[model samples]
Target: MKSQRFLKFYQSESEKYHGLRYGGLYGKLFKTLHHEALSGFLVQADNSEPILEIACGTGHTTGLLVKEGFDVIACDLTPGMMQRVSEQTGDQHEKVSFVRMDAFKLPFPDACVSTVVSTRFLHLFPADEQELIITEMYRVLKPGGVVLVDFDSWVHRWCWALPFALYNLLRYQRLAPYSIYNRIGRTITMASRVGFSDIKVDGIGGAQLLLPALISGSTALKVGRMHRRSVLRLIADQFMVCGKKY
Candidate 1:
């Protein structure tokens, strides 16, 4: 279930969320890097069974999965977001379904899903809650099933730390770490505890490190295009961790 805090935020933001997400060059860059990472996992997944996408905000990734020929259950905690997803995807694909649910308590049977994909959602909670969500995702995976989830990282925190701190202070009257090294480190440990093996972590959005130089629209597009390069992906601002249940 979506926390009251996040639920309220998304409810208010849903109307403009799609525009804000795709309107700017930075947003496009982030989306490109994110989809690249997601596609890499989906292509390797066993698509014989349905896949579950938790926190499927606006169905951007869900649409991709449907196009990839996987039956997808796209779930989110907010009805506003789910509605937007329906608007975006329409009724064109019969392989897709939308549901409202909590990430920590997914309503699925054990070992039932072939692949689980979540993006841009896990960083919302603290460490303990994140572990609970991870355990739940692991619980629903069939043997040999693959789980792909994204995490915010402190790898390039120095670049935007001050600005984010100021923004949070103005918005919430509190300073909080938006990205942290321990978040990803502890997530890997939690996945191990959940009995997920063959774990692999890949860095993404390294092009974000070039944000300082993106003064013009052209520069931003150039930097965004660099996201596909191998070396830049190694020092990314976020990461996607893939684990297989044995």
Candidate 2:
């Protein structure tokens, strides 16, 4: 199955994966952008109740939630990723529990969790699967509980589309690309249909729009850093959608 294949891939490439995605210079920049945009909402989360982090991916955001004083259940599909989370959390492991589970089928009961958060995971699936995953998150949340999720955005699709298309063509020998971009309108609509209300969305990581300069080793990093807080944030590479189940 595709799930098993991805699990093995993560297990084998865990180190390189995080290094490239969150540890490198560009990776750090991306993380800082994401953190700035999401921290406000996260800090305001109800810490008195238990939180579930689906597809936690080695506890990048899980560690943040734990440090913010939330009891976190960090769930991922790969044992290798969970092992990395154990190593990352260290003594804080007492406040964080790691579980291997599918996002489409969480093990928790309905209304058991006060908060559900996922990042950089949902956009990987097809539309139907994305809906199922969102519905699953909704199903396990308590009434009025919050669901925060991140997605790749189509706002600046023109910037990365060519590279992604070429990469897909060469790598898979097909035109199928790996990443999906969601429109803000569609994202909000999907959440409403999933029974969430008071929906809010924010854009982040506009540095990706300068991908050409970044690739050319130009002033893209400096420019991205300077303009990150400007109105250009509206055309960011990724978005976070927050909604409450009412």
Candidate 3:
């Protein structure tokens, strides 16, 4: 039932309340990760060509893309999210357009878009459905255009993995779910199957490391400055998988 809804169906309640709440807290942390993922594509973007953002929740990323002079078509499965995006942008924002649509089955014509970007949407799907989603993304992108997918990493859960599991069980008691796969690896492999080339993954934040860093005082911050890469590698909560449609 969950697989069917995620793959072939669109649910507003899932996209609105469940999706947005999770995004609100995790979104800020992954902005840096998104920037890194988008770096090359944003530089290459013509700004005049159409860009599509699937599952564009509150339009935070869409708004940023619009401000950068891109013609963005932002779509989500939820009407409430689309309305929220419109309200967030105000009526005067001409560069942005909103549509309500499912990610797994996009409504856009083939090869019509210069790029497709969807952030923080993969974990919602089981593995096979995730592959289907990537296939859909690849199908719509123009040749040489890129697909950028940002998702939570397995490494991030290391901080409080057991506790997080317990908390989810308690808070979402009625949901009846579990982590179905190692989302990070699954996303990478799925993108590869969809013919995405030049795939890359990177760490986002030092959230976990910060906990221990707090204990060491000035020495920790100093150590953080020198060994930033090491800290980021260990405490990465976000991962971006990017590739070009070939």
Q: What stretches of model 3 exceed 4 Å from their correct place?
A: 1-29, 32-41, 87-92, 169-171, 174-186, 209-231
As a whole number from 0 to 100, the lDDT of residue 31 in candidate 3 is 49
Order of models, best TM-score first: 2, 1, 3
lDDT of 1 at 34: 74
Give the better candidate number (1 or 2) by TM-score. Answer: 2
Models 1 onward score TM values of 0.84, 0.85, 0.75
Q: For every candidate structure, what is the RMSD over all alpha carbons to the true structure, in angstroms? A: 3.2, 3.4, 4.7
Model 1 alpha-carbon drift over 4 Å, by segment: 87-91, 167-183, 206-234
Per-residue accuracy of model 1 over 1-246 as CA lDDT, tens digit each: 338878998888888887776556666667766776778777769877878999988877887787677888888998888777765555656777877888878988888887999987887777777788989998999888999988777655555678767967996578873333434566678889988888877666643544544676566545544543455534567778899998
Question: Residue 38 error for model 3, in Å?
Answer: 3.6
For candidate 1, what is the TM-score? 0.84
Better of 1 and 3 by TM-score: 1
lDDT of 3 by residue, 1-246 (tens): 554454343344534543444353343333434554466447655566867988877665676677566778888876555555654455536877877777767897888887887866776767787788888888888898877776656665767677667867886673334344245566677788879888765555535545544575444444333322344644566565668877
Query: What TM-score does candidate 2 reach?
Result: 0.85
Model 3 C-alpha RMSD to native: 4.7
Model 1: lDDT to the true structure: 0.75
